[model samples]
Target chain A: DAGVTQSPTHLIKTRGQQVTLRCSPKSGHDTVSWYQQALGQGPQFIFQYYEEEERQRGNFPDRFSGHQFPNYSSELNVNALLLGDSALYLCASKINGGYEQYFGPGTRLTVT
Target chain B: AQSVAQPEDQVNVAEGNPLTVKCTYSVSGNPYLFWYVQYPNRGLQFLLKYITGDNLVKGSYGFEAEFNKSQTSFHLKKPSALVSDSALYFCAVPRAGSYQLTFGKGTKLSVIP
Candidate 1:
């Protein structure tokens, strides 16, 4: 009955640096999606992973990437981070083909 | 392109009063819409969704939404406002044939006690 969990609750990085965020899907959930939420704005889709392969991605550039482990956990990696990359990174999971997704607390990334 | 719009940037309501947060979406064919809420410094939580049947859908926390086909809108409603209910709400619609979702900018609800 565990909900989605994320690691590195808070992060600080300088411009051009790299950062990685981690997430563990809810128990029994198989699909994981990533999103970036800027202050005072809704989340923007990043990419999604299923069956250890990326299934779909948003309009974000290649600098943003992700991976899903066989255990249903996932990681979001950002390279050459910019100040605009500072935001809350959220990870959500749901059963395959399920419409409802449960989310984690999210990792806050701060780029200076 | 699929899109969702929350016309209101912020909404204020008196405690115990009913409240409505408007959301509108444009997409092809039958739309699969969803409502999500986010608290301060937290991730978005699923509130409800409308896939098919019953234009009026009830969701968690005594919240419900009405789907208006003619207007291409889905408005979130709650009979009574709670101070605890004050949070950011987002309306989202998945891209057709795509696994990603398009979300509204979000509406911030503030309930005055």
Candidate 2:
């Protein structure tokens, strides 16, 4: 089975610009979560989406938002991006209510 | 607040030697523990987890982790290290009933041939 997939493997955007990153959950998974990994650091939770609604969120600013579609795909949107927003965006998915999350390759966003 | 700490930033081991990467956690309730590995330019790959039951959990690539509730530690171990096992390892913990995980900074394992 195909695993989780993300779009736009790499991108470069200017500061203050907005960007959208997409993700397709692994086959048979329903819950989607997003994470940010800075260089040389572990991944940090951004937020989680279940049942098409955001269920839990981390300490991230309101600039980071996400949506989970009916087909279990997801999109992460960042507005007014700062240079610090540059990082690898990862999408993880698990079976309905199950805890083990399978991660995608991630989208590398570089804010210049 | 739940958190994880990987005490060592880097670990070196000779091929065929036993290796260990240490981790400790802090959480209010029972914690679910996990270990993941990441190669250069790759996403984190699940290694093993300790949710319930056995304290010693074996996972992919001949890796195992021992969970000690008394110490609130979960250390990953490999009996015979291989050069190919060199990579970055992360330790994470989730609060009871929560899927949101708190991750340690990560440990870089270098196995010399």
The clash count for each model shown is: 0, 0
- Estimate, for each residue in B3-25, the C-alpha lDDT of model 2 and write its tens digit: 89999999999999999999999
lDDT digits (tens) for residues A67-86 of candidate 2: 99999899999999999999
The C-alpha local distance difference test score for the whole of candidate 2 amounts to 0.92
Which residue runs does candidate 1 get wrong by more than 4 Å? none
For candidate 1, the per-residue lDDT at B59 reads 95
How high is each candidate's TM-score? 0.98, 0.96
lDDT by residue for model 1 (A78-104), tens: 999999999999999989887788899
| Predictions: Cα RMSD each | 0.9, 1.2
Summarize candidate 1's per-residue lDDT along B1-113 as a digit string, tens digits. Answer: 99999999999999999999999999988899999999888888889999999999999999999999999999999999999999999999998887577889999999999
Q: TM-score: which candidate is best? A: 1
DockQ (model 1, Cα):
0.76
What is residue A89's positional error in candidate 1, in angstroms?
A: 0.4
